[model samples]
Target: MSSAPSSTVFLASPDADTPAAAQALATIRERVLAATARGTPLDIQGGNTKRWYGQTPAGEPLDMRMYRGIVSYDPAELVITARAGTPLAEIEATLAERGQILPFEPPHFGPGATLGGCIAAGLAGPRRPHVGAPRDFVLGAVIMNGQGQVLHFGGQVMKNVAGYDVSRVLAGALGTLGVLLELSIKVLPCPVAEATLRFALPQAQAIEQLNRWGGQPLPLMGSAWHDGVLHVRLGGAAAAVAAARATLGGEPVDAMEAHAFWQSLREQSHPFFANAPLMGDGQPLWRLSVPPTTPPLAHSDEHLIEWGGAQRWWITPRAAADVRAIAAAAGGHATLFRHGDKLAGVFTPPPAALRAIGERLQHAFDPSRIFNRQRLYR
Candidate 1:
């Protein structure tokens, strides 16, 4: 629901000066054009930190790590443009210096996580439900299509577009549509205050409380339920956070401990994730996206409820179809988030009409099927 601004000054070219980035860009175009002519598929990669998140990569590796750096950043405008290979950590540090942040709260997974990988995966942190997804903050993107054509969509300023928003669509596409070269995203000022409170409750009661609180005007930033306890984070004005804390009436977590807890959850490094069975024949971790208002799901005790019960993570040995069916019945979808059968399809199968539309879009952008073939779907 965000748009680019109508008029804005063009900052320095994102690919300027860096000969390596320029070479990489030119090489990608040349390789893409040749691949298109010869029907050779290409697998785009940046940082490689998220290689295990989606289907197994195919085709020749096209490394994008060398093409990186902040293209432009206007603190006053609350926007930052960077090459696709720029490390996300660097961007966060830059924003921190300006007292701003990427509100979507993308996960780094590892030290090598890059901006392009973040966008490609489109994985948001706990703040997602309160703020928005990575796609919502995307203002513009420069990409190379299957035919090696360089195309630009959207721009630096919000409210700048009047047509189809292809920039946002590129998000979570897993490189099937094209090779991302650069991206521009909107940011926001850092919250003045933040606090986390924990309460011991059953899963059902936790879900109810979260949904109930969600309806109010409190400055809720994040929430999660695990180990027979519900943890809620509040952020905004100092007075507001304090008031909400008093009303919620839970044990206040130490400031330092709360910060570490959120970071662990964001990076999936917490013990809960570590203890989950690995991807082999054992139970694989499943991510279910359901409505927050939905009650505790069957076998829900074994799950970690996040996003105020909207995103549930469970490790189960059940078949993909069975897990997906349960999610679908609850008016949501399930994804084999990690350590699953990639060939069986990591995501829930889309409906016929949606599948057909996705096919059309894929063919339109990559007629030769030379980019990450079968990455998102078979």
Candidate 2:
């Protein structure tokens, strides 16, 4: 069990006083216990920005927004612990003040995004390939299970693992296992310099070039290909970024403009996203994860390649079976990312063995099935 220094700073909302928070936690616990006893379901909610994600939501609303605040932050130790409902904006602002950042670069889908929702959603931004994902940064977590028991897993430090690390499992769980109460995550120092460069090339050429650069010792942070343009972002020490820029040989974009470009891509606010409809049919968006070496898919006109070609965003009306088969042929899987018919299954079906293991874990953690039923899988 690791603890923060006593001189920790707490950034909390006005209504989230100590007594009120304690009472709120108690109420949540009681509600969970009652639901478990009655065999009812609980739909955990924070910020609700990502309510559209995952399968159709279920269970009674268990609001966690009142339990908001930063429990601890040690810049020297590169760790921050916060309550589940803490605002993502506040957390980022606090980290910015110390020239530190969450290396995973989790996206805030909307203004009211919360820390817990970000961790639960587990959606990383452009730097995900270069740095890591939300699960990689998770050091520890405190959660309330379906039985209303508070359980702690992992520790505040990265090396404290002694067995199965349950903390990381909570990432992308969609709150099916339990309700996350607090989380301690690792952070990294902000890069001293950053730049984005652009190259105009065909899809095949862009994929080849991106994969080639991936093997080299460069400050490559993010890469995306859209509209016949490949955008590469380099971040590190000033010298390294400049050296990589020279080696990459792409026209440099202005710093401010580049930042905005990346942000638009990250938040899906770019014109490409706005015009993602396939052949103007207003079809759903699909996400395909495949080997970077895989060639472009057939009839994928409205698409953007990201994560050095590992992630492909497709705006197509192709049937789920057809899209999934293509992704499988490419040696990966596909996800109906947004604006899709979720009832048809938003995620690819897991292998039988993997699904069995998930079921066992779910039963172990939530015997009564009181938490976010069928949100992750049917």
Candidate 3:
């Protein structure tokens, strides 16, 4: 839960200081209307944890903190519908009672994160490659577009095809597109057992090993690198996992320990985050996505590589030019994910055609571009 430190900080989702009521939706719509009439950018925000991921918006910031709750859930249908501002943890907890889980394995991202924020940012955790990305499971959304008019896409029904799939498109639009009100998505049953294995291998060696093993038969959920260590998690029937582990040659760590390990890894809570005399001061974190075949970073720095080597979470204190240079050399691009906004191009700049389409959509939805205009696209 988030506590409102001041008017400038309207904390949303599991707010420790504030529990948004059902009226938060009306309040949000009202504020949005006011902003549209005034033509001032609204500071669209959800989770502060991922705030450092991209460019800081320039606006009077809009926080969706007041709108939070699960609207409905059906265990038989394996679908859970909730308000946009519902905390992901709450949704997952509710689903757990029915033995269903978010197939995407979306990161809870602490208390302040909201379902709307997660979808808007298209944020995913280490399990993404195996389960699916955030947007993949997003079924529908009720949003208040730039004009403060409510809109719908998809629906609660899984077989729905009533309209354009702008629902998924809105997933990573970063609120520059529209303000999400409520969303419905599919959920899955949690695996019976889970385990994570960590190996102290050099980056190049680990890359080679994973590439080779990737060709073999095994249940590999996802892999990531933090500092100089490689961590891999496996989930499924307990028998298969045990067989896979025995053949993989990594020491086995049970579910409880693996959970703690992943939590620490995801939040940068391990020795990787510690101050070491040998490493000097650590640098900012950059999230890079590229082809898995891209060579290991030649730069002298630590990286947390995930998604079967397709994602590079590089940590270094390099200038924007240098970061972009590395990304180009590796046939990919970079965005500042943590500790550095100076080097990021927020919201992963889209292709020219997409940008034009985005602008057109932005104009059509928000004629004044008054909703978080300065936060994402700009």
In TM-score terms, candidate 3 sits at: 0.86
Provide the lowest-lDDT 10-residue window in model 3.
Answer: 2-11
lDDT for each residue of candidate 2 in 52-71, tens digit (9 for 90 to 100):
77888998999889887888
Candidate lDDT scores, in order, read 0.86, 0.86, 0.71
Per-residue lDDT of model 1, residues 1-378, tens digit only:
123343332366663547877787888888899889999889888888888777888899888887788888887788899989899999999878778889988988778889999999999999999999999999999888887888888998998873227899888999889988899999998888999999999989999999999999999999999989899999998999999999999999999999999888888877788755333244588999999988888874367899988999988878888888899999999998888676778988888998898889889889999898888876
All candidates: TM-score? 0.94, 0.94, 0.86
What is candidate 3's lDDT per residue for 1-378, written digit by digit as tens?
122122211113322223345467668888888988887888777765456545666687677756767766766666677777778778777777666678766655467778888887787776787778777787788788766678888876679855437877887777777788778787777777677887888887888777777787667777876667887888787897888888887766677888887776555565655531112334566778877767688887766678878888776777767887778788888776656445345445768997798778878788888766656644
**Regions of model 2 farther than 4 Å from truth:** 1-17, 162-164, 275-282
lDDT score for candidate 1 against the true structure: 0.86
Model 3 bad stretches (over 4 Å)? 1-22, 273-282, 341-344
**Better TM-score candidate (1, 3):** 1
| lDDT score for candidate 2 against the true structure | 0.86
Q: Count clashing residue pairs in model 3.
A: 9
